[model samples]
Target: MPLLLLVCFTLLLPPSLTAQQRPTTDGPSDPPARNWYHQLGGSVGWARNGNNDFGPAVALGIGAYYHHLRQFGGLVAGAGMGFELMNADREERLASLTALAEYQLGKRALRPLLRLSGGVALPVGSPGQSLDSRRAGALLHPSVGLLLLPPSGQWGAMVLDLGYRFTRVDFAAADNRGGSFEREVSYRRLTLGIATRF
Candidate 1:
């Protein structure tokens, strides 16, 4: 019988080569490609408004931003625009436009943001009947910010913001004795800033 079938095929070839060198067939390989939850960053911010102790309380601006990366869990949404230069002593220049929505808790490396903003404020180089008696309208803001990216790279980012604005104006504070005309003027601000992203 061919020498008893060659001794049972040489005892099954050393247990099939030691089960093909076990150790789960040379391990290693279980999801790891760096996506850090879809990276995206861009921002710039600065603001301030100290009610009194002087005019032009505080104002300085520069803005441009975009951030959207979070399918669910640590959400994000953004929009921005700020151009302000309100230096009292009749040097008023203002332009602010913004829209934002955010929520992030990606934990660590400085990332904390919660914001809401509304915009509209224009007044530059007075004239034309003082721009209809110093017209200032449509300004509502809400904010909170701190977002600095680079936990895994993809683009650069940095944002620091604190905001609050409410302004309404209709000049001509007095005209009387025998004339007739009241007054109205209101402007407010509170902002702190820093932003950069690409």
Candidate 2:
């Protein structure tokens, strides 16, 4: 969709908005020099399966990332790995291990962040859904969010994110009497969290 492409551009593109500061006097001398660090974050949110099925559910996650404030000579970039846990409905509980990458555009305390994540997930618990009865599936998620940081020396930030998640998992009959089938689930996700640099 066109909307998806727009989000990607906003995340990966250079700063053009007047609000974000442009390097003054050139030569990277203006912006403060603390260019790299490690960050950790945790979030809690809601997820919706399909419009007609499992309308609402709970989702949670935690992550660790390596951040480069001056990536590519000044662009902000981050890469990490994390885990996500969710329940689409009463009968399905899933957990995923994902690789995450993000690019940000900002120079002020408030900035826009775009991220993409991919990995695999499996059912952790649920009636008729267990390690023995289910197969791990692929997971893909893309999100756009705002990262609000304090002044240059500050060590923490507040984040708000909105994104979409898609997954496919297969399950077989408990007794193997019926053939296996795949369940493709898509979700609209909204979360709030905090991040701290180390």
Candidate 3:
């Protein structure tokens, strides 16, 4: 009976000793975790004005974004500005501002994303050359893309985006005899751009 008690005491004593000897210095605690990210990227795509007889037009844009990484996915928001040269003959310059939102799937190196954007577009230069009074109008964009995260400890990643954009502009023209006419221009764009995230 004494030997049995001695064996039981030995087994319990080791666990208590191990617990007492365990390190308690709290050495650094793994640096806490970061849950937010910032990204910047540029895009180039094509635009077509349905009212005009022009072929596919081209546009360029630059944007910055902020993302909150969550358990299910990431939420993204950002703003961008872009310019487009429309039609072959009109050669009109259009400037735009965009507000963006995105939902990203997966937390892996490569993830798929859906994006929506809306804002305004204005004529850059003298619309008087083509019309009398020109006004800026609303714009909308929706997109699907892929995001490629960098390897561990890297600074940048690649983004592939495909989207469609729509914009409208209103203008009025005056004739020589003090008669005026009003018209609207609608633009539809198919856009694709590659960007980097940091």
Among these predictions, the greatest lDDT belongs to 3
Task: For residue 172, give model 2's deviation from the true position in Å.
Answer: 4.0
TM-score of each: 0.25, 0.56, 0.60
Error of 3 at 10 (Å): 56
**Model 2 C-alpha lDDT per residue in residues 31-87, reported as the tens digit of each score:** 344666566666555654345455543454333233333344324455554444555
| Poorly placed runs, candidate 1 (over 4 Å) | 1-108, 112-130, 133-143, 158-162, 166-198
Q: Model 2 segments beyond 4 Å from truth?
A: 1-39, 42-85, 88-91, 126-129, 173-198
Best by TM-score: 3
TM for candidate 2 is 0.56
lDDT tens readout by residue for model 3, 1-198: 332443344345543233234343432111113444445555555653234347643543332333332222377776666666644344456777777788875444455677788888876543444566789999897887777655445466677777777778876766446787776777676777677665
Model 3: what TM-score? 0.60
Native-to-model Cα distance after best TM-score fit, residue 24 in candidate 2, in Å: 15
lDDT of each: 0.46, 0.54, 0.59
Worst 10-residue stretch by lDDT in candidate 2? 22-31
Worst 10 residues of 3 by lDDT: 24-33
